[model samples]
Target: MPEFTRRDIARGVALLGTMATLGDGSPLFAEALDAKTKAALALVNPELLSIARKEAAWRNGPPLTKNYLNIRKQIDGSVAPPLPDIPFAKHSIPVGKGIPDVIIYVINAGGTKRPAILHTHGGGFVLGSARSEIRPKQEMAKALDCTIVTVDYALAPEATYRVSVEQNYAALKWLYDHAATLGVDRKRIAVMGESAGGGHAALLAIVARDRGEVPVMFQCLIYPMLDDRTGSTRMPPPGIGVIGWDVPANVFGWRSFLGQQPGTATVPVTAVPARTKSLAGLPPAFIGVGSIDLFVDEDITYAKRLIDDAVATELHIVPGAFHGFDGAGADTSIAKQFTHAKMNALRRAFGEQSV
Candidate 1:
């Protein structure tokens, strides 16, 4: 039920009837489905979307803002290097025969086989690298003084969907099989990813659980790209012309990664975690997404579903912000609120809530 009033339904029928992807998806989807989710949503909410355009005005500041706000490159300068007077060793492990480009950054967290975080970076599964996550992972290492193995998995338009997910599974499997060598506890290992990587984390968590090998302590999914359907009313509202990410890019990302247009008959949950049914006996979870973000509704709905399935789940929806808001470097109060909330969520799940 979409809270759709009769008036909304009439309006939606008019809007969706004439909906077009011309003002939408490209470069990725050559195929079109006769779906108009955006139209239906507008009718249901009857609210206008206001995107702050003036924020992009030429600042003449440093070429890049120093706030460490690139979600792919978001980092704080005060972040110290790999925890307590201990030295961390870096290594490359096998993740699908050198396909995922998996790399590891390790440091002594100064405790018995400590809890570890298998961190994955997000770039719509096309643009981020393990290097981009270093600053945050370093900051996290300092915060909890725990072992973290940052993954550099393959991207889309090249490797596509399922490849990244399979790589994620491989990395986790290796960690579980050799937890002692990695200096982490197998039972306490958790999966963490942002955006597309977050989707990958969620999907891989399901994969690992189904395989019945490694047990995940928790999953930190930050504004994860979970859904596979492209044209549903779940897209960014039309009036909000925020670039960087939108319907076109989403379709392209899916086509490139899945090797087919999204919403196709063969699309799999391994490629889109939102399509999955079974959500039980996996792990405690922390999920966060901004209200206007493309994934907001899906994220909130997924959180509710997890709770419905008797899973321990904590979800926060940061209103007044859109997708990747925390990394956008906007001075809006909402961005900071979400950033702090996200950090707090990570801290709580990692057993470092005091920080």
Candidate 2:
């Protein structure tokens, strides 16, 4: 079997469609799919289906192994989008002895006390960088007129859960301590991220709550990869996780990040957000996911758990969509609506009038 490169997976995910073809270009489960599964596939949004058909078939790459280091290097070395025209500054803050300083980018900072966001970038906890997301963060900062701080947290396998979490917490603590200087209203700061970054954001909120130091006003989780058991011990319905970030990828990402097999009993509750028992006293949250995405069930369950614990939570489920649909199909109406809902949620959380 040919080993899959990170670029190959990235290209497949960029298409954001169903895995309708196998590695050898054969039909995917054409003869074996149950009626219920066919019905689910038919319900996929027409716009997304059109895009899905235009790409080469997606294959479940081999489990990430020794070659994962190569994958990480490829992702880190990928070309980043040009910096936005908006003004921003970068800083490297000391995390601890013998650890690299956490780098952060500040945008729309300074003036009077204004709402703020501490953003984390997603790469399944193993890949990605804050620099890659600068363009979108700059646009968000401009649109919302709030200070945005994006962190370059350490990735997993190389750093592990504890290191990354503490690094993020350090960034949060730095933002809170310097809010006045940055013209940010410390009390109105929110935490936000997409995919694994969303998981980190959720973890940061919980850590903030437990540490009794920094206060997080809101958490925005975009299709967060929260539960390690989603593709391991607990499986999704037939039509889910068949495209974009699928079962094999999920298992690899989780295993790499946790430094152990996913769905095991020994995983720490603090490391995986879904495993955390209490949601009380955590900030209000906005959780959004596509109905067919691998994480839909886990995200929804987390939202329900939060509401059950008396936390104010808003859960938005998009129909006929897959993971990363918003980015892959940005021009589609569904993606537009999803983005609008997210911005509106942030506006509400920041005490600004909705657009």
Candidate 3:
């Protein structure tokens, strides 16, 4: 029973350190708040609201650039609750020729060959690592009784889109190749991620489909940052603005990761999944996002595309939630329900009886 205080919530959300980039004079995606959004806000749990109020200040401050990279390290380095006492191992595998080794976190609860998860962490593509994602993966490993592997792919501005995607792709191949040794049932493996990692998971699924080598049974994207145009050209619904990572910060991340400004022709289709024309032949997907979060529109459209392409999809839109709602607002009923819904989706996907 790890109870998160208000400060802890702020720090955890701050680990991404991109969502809090909104300033007063900046343009808003929505002219005014929608009735439903307002209602949702009112229904938010009190603890989350308190945390949001305190975290809001970060949005009004100066632009967060590479100079702010240290913020991520500081927050991640801080003391937090201990991870679950689960059996695990760490590995550094080569991605490909002339590339750096990718670090991976492997957690196994012994019994039988079980389902597996290939996880990616969220940091707007500029921050975070496998270490940053341990807690949630630990929870999933225990809850689903599966082996979980969290990938430490290259970050942006240093490693461009090609490097990151290829590294994860190599990691996926490794998982498939070593499934027997890792005690993972080959067909039961799923790709799971939050925020930026969610987008990476989606990309990994596409690559798996294209290569026809690794078979990804499912994709779990939690409040994923899917579209580069989302931070550049997309206009959100009225009253749905500045809740999670701000536009400038979003653009900064996309630019750094893409190695060019988002929405530009230079950004190839392979670099951004939202730019992909066909969603058919992809794995079953679970896409979740907050209504007021910056990614809501892109996430919804992606889900619809998946459905239209006849890909099995489960989309959860939390009415009054903001970015990282479950992480920042973990103590609330809505957050609990939100988290439970994802776990249920996994249970169903893996053919386990619902809890």
- Winner by lDDT: 2
Residue-level error in angstroms, candidate 2, position 165: 0.4
Off by over 4 Å in 1: 1-88, 96-101, 107-110, 232-244, 330-336, 350-355
Over the stretch 126-235, how does candidate 2's per-residue lDDT look in tens digits? 76778766777888888888999999998877887878888888899999999999999999999999889999999999999999999899999999989999989999
- Superposed model 3: Cα runs more than 4 Å off: 1-11, 14-47, 79-84
Total clashing pairs for each candidate: 8, 0, 3
Comparing 2 with 3 on TM-score, the higher-scoring candidate is 3
TM-score of 3: 0.88
User: In candidate 3, how many Å is residue 185 off?
Assistant: 0.2
The alpha-carbon RMSD values of the candidates against the true structure, listed in the order shown, are: 11.5, 4.9, 5.2
lDDT of each: 0.59, 0.79, 0.77
- Count of clashes in candidate 3: 3
Error of 1 at 183 (Å): 2.8
TM-score of each: 0.72, 0.86, 0.88
Candidate whose TM-score is highest: 3
Query: What is the C-alpha local distance difference test score of candidate 3?
Result: 0.77
Instruction: Give the better candidate number (1 or 2) by TM-score.
Output: 2
